[model samples]
Target: MASWKFPGFLIFFTLFSCSFSYTFTITNNCAYTIWPGTLAGSASPRLSTTGFRLDSGQSVKLTTVPGWSGRIWGRTGCKFDTMGIGNCETGDCGGKLECDGNGAAAPTSLFEITLGAGNGQDFYDVSMVDGYNLPILALPKGVYGGACNATGCMTDINLGCPTELQVLGGNGYQVGGVVGCRSACEAFKLDKYCCSGEFANPNTCQPSYYSTIFKKACPRAYSYAFDDGTSTFTCKASEYAIVFCPNSNGNQKPNPAPASPPPPMRRPHPKGHVVPSSSNIVLLPFPVPMLLLVVSLSFSFIVERPWPVI
Candidate 1:
């Protein structure tokens, strides 16, 4: 009887733990290799890995505790030694292979998320507010219900990047071509572009010509500092897939996919919620009764099973 009790409790514990955690599947769908980096928010716990090399077509899974909040980005044109010491052409974090809590540099596409606690909706978005280094697509998987619309910027903004804001590839890899597109604020540090100083309020700060260019190209991505209305998304999902340089068709052409409709307006974020400058945060109650029922049934079956006496 004692041995059976221990096994039953272990099974229940495992299932309960799985119910609360969420999985992030990070994939490199680009033609070239990319090193992905992750940065946890000041209040959130860090993931198991801060960064790692991911070759084309490779995917890695990362699990996070409930309510984990962080940002993920890809670094391109990286050259590292045996000790993983080197820098990437774009999205480099302190010139190290493993970012180790370092945030990505400007001019990089970012996938930011603030996961909710048990049975709560997650807020996520692919942001170009920092700029655009590579195309990114974020898709939520295993959504129990509610609006789990896919959000991302698949357009290769570098091709049409304004000359002043273009980040040319200094390395020989992309010579004579733009490798990244800098935001107007990043290119020119002004009150209007940066949304700082007296222009901090949404009413005072408006979109610039450069921001319009990005918004027109990628309708779903966050083009500027306060692009929350159309850019932020919420979903109660078991997993999320963040694809870097996603190839929609069979080829490498960076064709944009049809934008998903904005999610229905929901309640505002709870008090004390940390809203990032580039995105507005929100939450929804997750349906956990069904999940709990399934776990309970499994636990009961395990406990009732007749065991051969040792």
Candidate 2:
């Protein structure tokens, strides 16, 4: 027997006085949030807990939270590791692909952080186990950097829109869902970061891949930092706040240099005259609830053992 947890509620309903055949569809006479998951119309092809098929006019009252821009015409795997960036011919890639976020424009609203059934509407936190799907091709610009995971953006892929296309020229780590992204000239402090969480989730991965990705991405704390796909640039010793920029690459030789750092912790204010303007700030606005999701080997061992000859 196999059991899994994804707040997907499958409902098959039809509208209009007609009989139709739909490969996939969702229709209901009521308004119910689909797992209350984050639905951003961006470029990262995230794991969707609630994916359904529709036949033409059928509807799911997702107006309160909004579903994908258009429709769930077909299913595809994660964008990364799909051989080619925009190629997702398979149904589910099974975490083999890395995730790069949409580059053209960011999601226009607070698409992250819907609380659980018990939690209030003001509930949200960075996802340690799941993310949303973005069809980059659907964006007006046709490209993106990627959403930043707790670790970093994985890589570039097609926008999870109605078309298939490729757009690059980012640090390959802009993939992010609930956290602020680190594309362009953005900067972040690590101390105030809530990126570090479980290094692995047994519920999502096979025993082999779980151990491999976890071992590789573990040891290092998870964070959505300003990175260049080759290195994570956040200051591990200090709190961080991100400021995104348009031209982050060093090649754009423009404008006079900004004021240089005088020295470490050297403020212009007089001694003992602390100012409110330079106070501490939280990098991410939303609060996270869960701890590191990485399961220990002992926990892993027990899960695999299973019921004894039940």
Candidate 3:
């Protein structure tokens, strides 16, 4: 009986540990096919397949052990031969079908996550810091915490991307020759735009004109390096569904209306002072009651204003 007890306990422990593993259900809702790529962080384990073809309207589920950390992005306009040697229009990884350990190229939107162990909260975000290739929506299911809210960039930013920062697609690509939107850093390679060198810290680095455009279009996504106040999300989810080109269902939040004009570029404050920048503003959705109250007040103030004689 004593000998049997040890084996029974061991089996139970293995099963318990396995239960903590999480699943990522990647779906392609775009009209065309896209190859999804996965890149594990330096300290994390690689997934089963580094990359694979995901046809339109199809979905694939990948499992990850507890505490996994990685980034996933979609590759478009790929044409690989039998040998799996080829390139993609956007988000290519060393011109290969399987990324292996390679990361996605710039001008690619990324769904980045670090899963928690056991019941710990997971941190996740959809980042455009590299740039924008395709719109993505990440929805967490079976959330253990109250903070599990859907987040992603659902707007096709390429339509409004500046000419200088555009990535033109090849012969078969869509959207009038433009495909991806390059980051200011990718377009100019300046330390001020890249948030490197003298501007490495948040106090010294603020959103540039270009990043502000992305932030306005996709308020919940990471537009630049220091866009954490509104972009980062945390939850303890059993699984996450990452949908590429998500359809305009009611679940998806509509993009905010275009602002009158972007704020002027903010110069970094002198070092050692913690001045707040636009990137630090928390732009989360307001509760319905709060939103209504704000609108009512604004309307009342406008009505009360007296017209001045010209």
Best-matching candidate per lDDT: 3
> Which is superior by TM-score, 1 or 2?
1
Instruction: Provide TM-scores for the models.
Output: 0.77, 0.18, 0.77
- TM-score, candidate 3, is 0.77
Write model 3 residue lDDT over 1-310, tens digit each, in one string: 9999999999999888766557787877677789999987766767878888887667777876667777899999899999889999999999999998988888888888877666656777788888888878787777775646677877777666777877898854456677788888878878888888888767888988777877878877777777767777777888887888774332332242332111112212112111111011111221123232223223211111111111
Candidate 3: C-alpha lDDT: 0.70
Pairs that clash in candidate 1: 119-286
Clashes of each: 1, 42, 0
User: Sorted by lDDT, highest first, which candidate order results?
Assistant: 3, 1, 2
For model 3, what is the error of residue 308's alpha carbon versus the real structure, in angstroms, after optimal superposition? 53
What lDDT is obtained when candidate 1 is compared to the true structure? 0.69
Off by over 4 Å in 3: 1-14, 248-310
lDDT of 3 at 182: 82
| Model 2 CA deviation exceeding 4 Å by range | 1-50, 54-59, 62-112, 116-119, 124-310
